[model samples]
Target: MASKIFHPIFFILLIFIPLAPIGHAKRSSPSDKNSSPFNFIKKLKGCQKGNSTKDIHELKAYLEKFGYFSYENNAHAMDDDFDDTLESAIKTYQKNYNIKPSGIVDDETISKTTTPRCGVPDIANSINYMQPRDNNHESSSSNIHTVSHYSFFPRSPKWPSSKTYLTYRFISNVPTYARAPVARAFQKWYSVTQFSFEQVPTNQNSDLVIGFYRRDHRDGFPFDGPGGVLAHSFAPTNGRFHYDAEERWSVGSVPGSYDLETLALHEIGHLLGLEHSRVNEAIMFPTFSAGQVKNLHPDDIQGIRALYNQ
Candidate 1:
């Protein structure tokens, strides 16, 4: 499992200057929001000028993360010079990110690469967007049930009764804080279900395994660059939840932050055989924003109940 190489230029910029100012200050700048497709290729070409031998591992890692690799017998190749291979990779990355696949890096692509992977913009103090709307009745359209109805329901399997356990393993190392929210997330899932799920001892065989790594984990899905995608998972067959450790994960109630616990809950849902929900209010929705909590909203309950009725 290698990470995808979507926006290599943006990532390199971040590393060289962590606090460097954005070139454009106004929100309306054309380049501020769009990024050209050839940005990474151009950068790679520039870097190659100074150093003849370049490490394609970084680019290879990026491609693997976003579910794009050689399909023919699982064999893949990386081009030393930004050639046809690079062009194809760019198009694939653009398609996944919802950008135009013109094969020319533009400003909009850059914006998407830099913005936080998930979460809505905070407009509390700004006079631009209006305040949040309120409805007397629970938002029916926002209801999770609206989306759960269409998920692929998995047959209930016999799970451990007393000692059902989940484990989180990092390929190299993970921050202590990172593991904490994931544990809390697992607990949140356990609270709503009849099955009692708990964290097993560090070295014990586990019912579910949660893995965190940069690139090339056991399963196929690899990680993309830092901001493009947060993480992905394998369904019930493996019960593996892998998060990109490179991401700046948030774990608490914040006005404009990505809650780690919330993400874990969503990924865990996938592990349990739940698919992305069409309902915006559902936690299982494919895209999430800041201020969205990870708890099982009523709709999630309805969907889970559909799977296991007690």
Candidate 2:
């Protein structure tokens, strides 16, 4: 309703969740088996101003994983140093997520980073890190990621045209309030494409199953708890959409709460076979504000249409 405000605490609740890599379950950071990957975010909060620690190195790796920080010899970049470039990248990341650009890794920063999210990254470089386009129209730019319009998947996968209507079911304990928010996301996609979503019974082998999950919920990418990733969906026809049950989810533009509907729009783009945009204003852009109201931007609409030929 009102223009969403950005208080320090306003964004602390919004975590930057990453896309879970689709494959056999992957290994987490080299921590004790009993520890959560999210612990790295918490430990990062302890790094003092103008200092470096093991946790800071891990934080750099985490940011690099999503196309944030990079060095030519990244092999040794994680050797525990909170240098100027790393701090700049961290500040850029904070600014992107609507967090104050404090540059120092504080409890507030780690608090947001600790949440589990979709396995997908905000930047879709070379289509799945190393996978490239057939034509080679795009070249690698600076380490910083930006919107490259009308992007496709690593292999550019999509659903067949004949099968237009996709069945989506709510699995696990999706609350009553969550229904409309989730439905609105589906409606937004439907408006832009020939695709329509049908809600079916849970665990009924539908095309898409929407639900909340906790740590190590089978698909290799484990949930790291409340501050890291928000939700992730599989590439088309796989039909698996999962949200982190641990997040403080809210339906609308509420401070200190995740706008699930906005996230749904982003994840659904991934489901329909689109990649992250280089255009920051596009919905597919990697980072999103916690309290902002967003519709599909013109660039986002263009990207989707380009993929589906709508």
Candidate 3:
């Protein structure tokens, strides 16, 4: 190898010239209120199949992260091309969120994309629980065919029949004030379901556990700071529910702050083995906006009943 030395003039020129960015620009994390991961999606609004841009790569990654992209499209995830797979994924996402499913990134789609939501994948194990389906398998009291949007985790796993009285404990990091809202959330579930719940000591082993975490906390799913993923929970028997500690959580109807009790209610539903629901009114819905509050819908009630054969 040969080594070359720059002249004094070259050094002077280097000082005067501006250097281009080394690689891609630093992307803002979800918690960044000014710019979120979905900002790229906003730039992609009106884009469809055959249109290509560097921003499409980010959109593909977002879809893949939420289980919208298929395995066969993995090779193209990093590419900027918007192909058939990308279009199909968008359509599925549109359908799941009750949009027109035109397969184009439209204003409505972009609006939904920007909202804060749960960390649970809308599609799990290749199953899209958000897809609308008929409730024919279950023995319903009515003869009319009913459309169901609520779903359960794969295999519909639930607490053992012998374990209806489940106990839960809040980890040490959970604040004292947050405990009341969480307890009320459990009471909401107990009001409708046959199962009962009791609180246990944090050190004692309990049927379920709850805590607040920020960023990557060793769990496979990490909290996305203040604005992105608000919380996530594991499926039945593996009762782990977590909240993003960085979020502005409130028990009252405060603007710009997420109601802790509302989110806790949703996570508790997931703790009971329910997956994301297509019904926007249901607590199992994947997305939740700040300052919004919701209770269990009929779909949620029917889902829990069907899962436990209550």
Q: What are the lDDT figures for the candidates, one per model? A: 0.47, 0.65, 0.78
Q: Whose TM-score is greatest here?
A: 3
- The order of the candidates by TM-score, greatest first, is 3, 2, 1
Candidate 3 stretches with Cα past 4 Å from truth are 1-32, 72-75, 134-146
The per-prediction CA RMSD against the true structure, in angstroms, equals: 14.8, 11.4, 16.9
Clashes of each: 30, 27, 0
For residues 11-50, write the lDDT of model 3, one tens digit per residue: 1111211121112323233354654445667788789999
> How many pairs in model 3 have backbone atoms within 3 A of each other, for residues 3 or more apart or on separate chains, i.e. clashes?
0
Model 2 Cα lDDT, one tens digit per residue, 161-212:
7767777778657755666667778888877777777676676777878877
TM-score of each: 0.51, 0.65, 0.85
Q: Could you tell me how far off, in angstroms, the CA of residue 22 lies in candidate 2 after the best superposition?
A: 25
* Positional deviation of residue 105's Cα in model 3 after best superposition, in angstroms: 0.9
For model 3 the TM-score comes to 0.85
